[model samples]
Target chain A: MMIPLADLVTILPELIVVSAACLLLVLDPITPSNKKDLLAWMSVATLGVCFVVTAGSMGDRVFAFSDLVVVDGYASFWKLLLYVVSAMTILLSIGYLKEERIDLAEFYGFVLLSLTGMMIMVSGADLLVIYLGIELMSISLYIMAGFKRFEAKSIESSAKYFILGAFSSGLLLYGISLIFGATGSTRLVEIAAAVDARGLDDSMILIALMLVIVGFGFKVAAVPFHMWTPDVYQGAPTSVTAFMAVASKAASFGAFLRVMLEGFGGMKPNWSGLILGVCILTLILGNLVAIVQTNVKRMLAYSSIAHAGYALIGLVVAGWVGTEAGVSAKGVSSMMLYLAVYSFMTLGAFSIVAILRRGGEEGEDLDDFTGLAKRHKGAAFLMLLFMVSLAGIPPTAGFIGKFYLFMAAVNAGLTWLAVVGLIFAAVSAFYYLRVVMVMYMREPSPDQEGETRLALSPTAFVVLALAAAGVILFGLYPWPLVSLTATAALP
Target chain B: MSVPVEFYMVLSGLVFIIGLVGVLVRKNLIIILLSIELMLNATNINFVAFSSHFGNLSGQVFVFFALTVAAAEVAVGLAIIIALYRHHASINVDDFRLLKW
Candidate 1:
């Protein structure tokens, strides 16, 4: 029953976030209204420390809490990504919070706490731990989505998200229970071993796996389970929407990869076709629907769904090609790399949205950005960078991400899905480019009276710099990231 | 003292179906929330039942976690519903349609 202190050190990043969240909860009442910016800074600092701790653990693998929590290359990669995204989100929130008059200590606290949940989710080795991590993240996000207490849409969005999220959690827990019944364990590795030992192909386990997929599908905003995303993204404050778009999706995919690749590796054949069908549907539906959207935020929401579909291609390929072809780690690494790049590009895109909301107005509609190039040239440039990256144009990270994913798929003999994805990618380019054309070509709306000029906060500037740099740098020199991704083996 | 697994499975299935119907068919926001709670409790019951049937504690522990999560969800869900009610002055899903396809 003795827990090793060394194992505890391995999960220091999660510990840091938990303590920071608790600290913020306690500090909220004592801090005066004029000084609440301190809380935002504290959240940023906490995420920074967590990032350092996660970075320190790179290449070190250890299992803690009796193998219920693992620290490995995959976990470290995701933890670092989560911390970086969380930090950028806090920065983006600073300007949005000030403009919306939503400056509160609890807001930042919830962001950090939710990020803690995401961190735990990607690292959890036990099914129970995964469920707990998911709830922790979900509960915090539900509150943050409704942080604008006076806004009707914000409240509605949060209500819908909470109701649906709870329902999905139930489905996931039930699935885990069924798997536990069949395999006699909730530890993922243990469950895999049980399945192998018994050579069991129980129907109960299949149902369980399907339930889990449905549950996670909701989180990742995949088609048929993505009803809440557009509404929520449109309703929540722009900063929160950005956080939801980037961090939440990355975290869900992180856990999704772990659960499928680690827990249900043996059942790949059963679920691969189901995921493939969903991926195609999501890609087609997400892109085709996005093309008709007038609101930029809503359009991005649909685009996020389509991107999830693309990430699923990497996952399906990982399962089929890695396991079936005995490539062991290449396919999974490719999926992980896609996830990492997707996180950066998506965050950068949202960062531009966050920056453009000036003078107390949350400019989310596509028209709100008419002639933005004249109003704020630097931000317009960044926005253009994000859009091009999102469109998978050359010399941006998004292109490489999609390239590797398609390569992985083709390697797995999923040539047709890859081709179909490319077609959708081209279809998606119209909307992404439409934003660019509006920014550069249109005349500024006289009614679009702002402070006339936009200024970037230090945090937002950093986010923009990192994201823009990442898109371009990774596009130009992808070998380093590709190699790093290749080295991170999945268990 | 062995209870049938079919009984638990059937009960959970019914509860899940009820939730699905509530989400798909109900117009009242509160009813939808209640249905979600019902669905979660159904899962908890299944977890406990499986734990007992298997004579293991993992499912029981998971049930406890699920219950905790359900409680947190209700707290947040209710707060959100209350906020929505304040703004729209209605608890019906049909009333809340600012952004439509």
Candidate 2:
């Protein structure tokens, strides 16, 4: 079979990432052992180039490789977000890797590769393409999660993540097969059209939809399917946890949006109720459970799960409002904006955790953060900003994101769900505020009175700057990003 | 020479159930990993069965991709298990409670 050259060009972002991974693999041995920072810079540069290429394809829609893959405004938007998150993650990982003594080339290489997989997943128009993209992303993540092989906790986290991830993939594949058998097509657009033509029974469609939901729900860490998140997030390195919280969440949501809007547009009525129920459970359970956790990382883990629930509200509204009214666009755009803001805040929070590590020990417990304001005022201020933003306080991006999502819900007539979400939002505020109070009100430990030193690495400074700037800038003037997201409609 | 679709579905369901049981009940980490592989293979079988039934090659192509993913998953899974074993010197799931409530 002769492959079309044009299709390859359309997927240039993925190609760039794969090539970068291979280059890192080959060049690591040749470089001196002490100069591994060069590899880190190279990885950052590669992500930068990939971002540029992805941006170059903006506002241009094209189907490639017999429609197995697509390049559209939606794909470009998600690809850009993924690249940005990946780049910031690489920056965050620099000081983190040095502090932890894990200066391996393959760590950065796997991050890039996983990012490539995410890019492909967002753009994939066919079942096979989506599956490949998911695997590509997941396999790399499994390795990256366990990069600290000497740490037993890291290894256990990797194993748990792998087992759960594989199980979900199996469910997804089986669901895809069932849908293919029923509709006789694996192409998303074709599947939609087939279901329309044949008018499949409600039961069969429900079963298939349930399987897909279970699979993607696992990816997004939705309730009843989120047993592994806190363990994995707490056990993985802080930088990798940041990547998982941001990039993986965004990627999974991207894939979810595509599948629902494109593949199962006609079957919205069937799956909407299921999603609503899961969203409610996730919101209540995730937030309520997070309050009792003393480990800051685990709290953030549960917070991530709660945020997934919030994003699901947008998805529910998108499905409920139907496509003709353009409410789906608004809902999805809110989701995108929320994800963008979320990435910055979460990364900043994790970077603060990484900064507090002393002598290579992971001091991420809540007590470790007591009197952080006195020790490192700048880091404390940034952490306070992140917590406030995460709590959806006004003058921060999180508030605006939540406001738009609630507005979308009301517009879609999901008033009850919106009210439930608002109540949980209030409940979630307590934990986020607890972090701020600890930073500001509590006194520092009496270990050493004179050693009030703040270890401000250049990388931590960048992380703080980007996160604080992103939250404030996007909070004050979110219209531009909102318009950009609204314009990037799914096909 | 036609195999019924229900037969394949039933077989896949059985395989999936067994895998689920192993995942939920197994004490050894390696056994859990093996169970995940079994689940994936069941999915592949369903994909191939559907492909043949529909007279479309996409399902078969999907099966090949699934196999590749399964292999990759196994490689990573075993590597993590080995790392865990080296650390704790045992593969018992109950003993791996570093992050429990």
Candidate 3:
């Protein structure tokens, strides 16, 4: 089969990233251990180039590969965020990998490869393409979660994630097959037309929709399906955890929202209620469970689950008021903005968790943060800011993200759901503030007296600085982000 | 002269449920991996059944991708199981509980 040049050009970003990943893998064995940072830098450079290439295609909608994938403002918006997150993950890992004595160049390659999967995921307009994209992304993550091969926890997390991930993808693929059988097409546009023509009474379509939701529910770490998150987050290397928490969730949300809104827009009444139930359960369970966690990583993992709940509100509203394209746009854009703001604060928090190690001792437990203010004011202060933002306190981007989501909910005549969200946001503050209190008020334990020094490598410092700047800058001036998301919202 | 599409769907659905149950009930890591493959192949069966019924090639094309991905997953899954076995000398899922909440 002859492929057209236009199709090739449309996927240039994905091609570039994949080739760079393969190059890094080939170079890994020959590259000396001392010079592994060079591979990370190369990955970051490749992401930078892909970012620009994707930006050039922004604002223009182009379908390629027989409409299997699309390049549009919506996809580009997520792609840009994924690139930035991937670059930060690589930079943060440079210091983290070395500190943990697991500095394999293949780690960087996996990051780029998984990012390529995410990029393809957001751009996929067809079910098969999206499935392939998700599989690609997931397989890399399963490997990255076990990058610390000698460590039992790391390998265990990898096994758990692989089993659950493959299982979920199977569910996803089954749903796709059912939908195809019902509609005789896998393209979102055709699926929508078929759904509209068939009306909302089709049991097959409803079953398929539920299965798809369950599949994506597992991917985004929503409650009842979030079993793997805490273990995986707590066990994986902190840098990889950050990547999974932010980039993976964002990509999943991007594809999830697309599939729901574009493919099943006509079935709003059916899905909105189900999603509302999920949103409330996630908010309650995610926030409530996070409070009892002793390990900081597990706490963040649950907190990330709660964050997914908050984003789900946008999805619910988008479906609730699906008849009005204008109102649904607000819901969609709000979700996108929420995930974007979420990316920064969560990444910053994990960066601090990754950096606080000293001489192979992991500083991941809540007690390890005691009296951090006295030991290292800068690191403590950064953590405090992230915790504050995460708690949805004012003068932070988290508050702005929440504000818009709630506003959309209220606009869609779901003020009660907004109240439920607000209550959970308040409940979430207890844990976020506990971290603040530990850093500032409590005393460092006797045995950990000299061991809590911050290992601030220059690359990690840059990551922290970037994340902090993003949180504060977007907090103060959200118009730029608001408008960017508004323009990127699906038409 | 040909098997009805509904029969294929029913057969695949049963296979899928069996795979899911195996994943939940099985204690061995390798068995769990094989269970996942069963689930994936169930979907592949559904796709092929639908593709032939509809006379559309896209569903068949999807099966190829699914097959490739399933193979990749097994490679990665076996490698991880090997790593876990190296440390614990066992492939029982219950043995790997150092990361519990």
Candidate 4:
């Protein structure tokens, strides 16, 4: 019944996050509605502390709690992303919730709780721990999605996300049980060792792998499993969409890598083919369908799915060829880099959408962005950077992210896959730059000419500015993030 | 007259298939939630079967966690349905179509 000291040390970041969430919940009752922003600010500060603690506890590669959790560079890398994404989402929400009259303390609390779940998910070494973490993150997200209680779209978003989320969880759980049956263990290392010892020709192992992929495919919004993404992204509050698109997706990818690389590393060739097939389908559908969408949020939703395809390339390469050093896995590091860059660009893009929401109307329609440069130059400029970067243009993080992913692919001798990804990247630029053209070239219409400019809250402005800075800064100087992810590549 | 482990697994697989079919085919929100629970319980049955077969405690241990998670999931599921019902005035999955492609 005794817990290990190593366990406590490893769980320190999670404890800090969850405890802060609980404190905010308790304090919410006494605090006035007008001052709910305090909870948001406080939550951001707590996440900041989590970032620092995770950074500080980075030296040893220790597996705690009987190796159910790992305190390694990979965990550290993901925890940092989770904290930054949650913090960015909170800042984005403060301006957003105020404009919409959704000034709730629980919103901040849930953000922290959900972030805590992601932290657990990336750190988890056991299948059971990973599944529980996913559930915790998913349930919080469903409630958060429905935060705009009276709105039908918001409620519907919550409903669809929950049902599908639960269904996927069931599939994932069944897969885990099957894997357990085949290997007689749920620990990832033991599973891998079992695979090594027994070999990969077992039909049960193959079925379990497919079930697990479907579960994660739904999470990452990959093509055959991306039915919920557009609706959820369009319907959920902009801030929540940003959270789901980046942090939740990153967590899913993180768990996916851990399971594939660690748990099923022995059968890399098997999962690699399946990942390659889905990656191709995801790229084509996400880009092609995205072009037809006029709604900006939904476009970005599909864009996120396409980005998942690009990251999947890294997964394949990492499995097939691996990283530069070959000692540490290169595949996950590139995927991590892509997700981190994506978090900034996508959130920056969504924060602009959040800024547009004033007087109760969501400014997500494509026409809503017409003549934005004329309306507000600074916001328009930031949005341009996000869009350009998202299109993988130079001098932005998005380009650097895609570059690392493709380079990893080429390094792994996946030049053919990289070529396919390049074609999709070119196709993606059309939709992304279409936003740019609308903002800069189009003129305001008769009625829209004198419409008042959307007010940007200080926090939201700061959020957008931070995201923009990260995009350009990382793009220009990618080595720091590159090295960090490399160190965190394997265990 | 002893039952083989394969029989239990077949039973669980049939139950799991029925539950999955219910989830995909049923129209009622509450029934869909129940179907999900059934799917999870089928997994629970598998876990215990494997645990006994493997003579390890982890599979049984996994069942407890899965059951607890399913309970929590249902609570959240029902809460969301209530919220949805408040707005749409119905609990049918087909009626909840505020979002589409």
Candidate whose DockQ is highest: 4
Could you give candidate 4's per-residue lDDT for residues B17-91 as a string of tens digits? 898999999999999999999899989999999888877998998998898889888998899999899998899
Question: Which tens-of-lDDT digit does each residue in B1-101 have in candidate 2?
Answer: 89987799889879988987898899898898888888887877787887888788878887888888888888878888888889999999899889782
Best candidate according to TM-score:
3
> What would the TM-scores of all predictions be?
0.96, 0.97, 0.99, 0.98
Q: Give the alpha carbon lDDT tens digit for every residue of A427-491 in model 3.
A: 99999999999999998877878887777889999999999999999999999999999999986
RMSD to truth, every model: 1.9, 1.6, 1.1, 1.5
For each candidate, what is chain B's TM-score? 0.94, 0.96, 0.97, 0.94
* Candidate 1: stretches off by over 4 Å: A1-3, A197-201, A321-328, A445-455
Candidate 1, after superposition: displacement of residue B93 in Å? 0.9
Summing lDDT over every window of 10 consecutive residues in candidate 2 chain A, give the lowest-scoring window.
A448-457
Residue lDDT tens for model 2, A179-215: 8777878899998997777663656666888999999
Considering only chain A, what is the TM-score of each predicted structure? Answer: 0.96, 0.97, 0.99, 0.98
Instruction: Report per-candidate DockQ.
Output: 0.70, 0.73, 0.81, 0.84
User: Compared with the true structure, what per-residue lDDT tens digits does model 4 show for residues A338-371?
Assistant: 9999999999999998888534687888888899
Which candidate has the top score in lDDT?
3
True contacts kept of each: 0.67, 0.68, 0.81, 0.86
Candidate 4 local Cα displacement, residue A349, angstroms = 0.2
